[model samples]
Target: MAYVDGFVIPVKVGDRQAFIDHARQMDAIMIEEGALRIVECWADDVPEGKQTDFHRSVDRQEGETVCFSWIEWPDKATRDAAFARMGQNEVMMKTPMPFDGKRMIFGGFEPIVLLEKANG
Candidate 1:
């Protein structure tokens, strides 16, 4: 089964383009380090909930937006190796993230279910 690393990030609403640019750079590094695919999504219709929500989960501020992202790997071992390699990557070390890294939430997951449409 494939492995996945998921993330919920809090980004400044005004830095949308900067965030994309940063993701583009960092995502390429992830790919080079062995990630199979990278998907980054900006908030569109996120709603405020009384108890909890995506925004509350990440402690999003008034001027920030929630971003959902994921990285796919062939397997857990590959993902682990890639992460180790990324830790020493020069570009990754030099590039600065546009969002507040401290507020970002991330975790590795083994998918329980996955579905895709036929290519037809």
Candidate 2:
């Protein structure tokens, strides 16, 4: 089964381009470190909730947009090893994040089921 690392971040509206540039750099590093693929999504229709929501979960402030992202790995072992390497990685250490790191939420998930459409 494939292993995945997922993230949700709140970025200021004015910083969108900066965030994309940052993500590009980070994605390259992750790919070099063994990530199979990286996917990033900018929220289009994220709705506010009365009780709990994506916005509320990240304590999103006014004029901020949510970014949903994920990195895919072949398996848990590779994912673990890559992350371990990232800890001491010089580029990662020096690269500044475009968004608030404290407010970002992230987790690792083992896919229980993934359905795909047949390609012609």
Give each model's whole-structure lDDT.
Answer: 0.94, 0.92
lDDT string for model 2 (47-85, tens) is 988998999889999899999999999999999998899
* Alpha-carbon RMSD to native, per candidate: 1.0, 0.9
Model 2, runs deviating above 4 Å: none
C-alpha TM-scores of all predictions: 0.95, 0.96
lDDT (0-100) at residue 102 of candidate 1? 94
lDDT per residue (tens digit) for residues 8-65 in model 1: 9999999999999999999998888888999999999999999999999899998999
Q: Residue 51, candidate 2: how far off, in angstroms?
A: 1.8
- Candidate 1 local Cα displacement, residue 35, angstroms: 1.0
RMSD, candidate 1, Å: 1.0
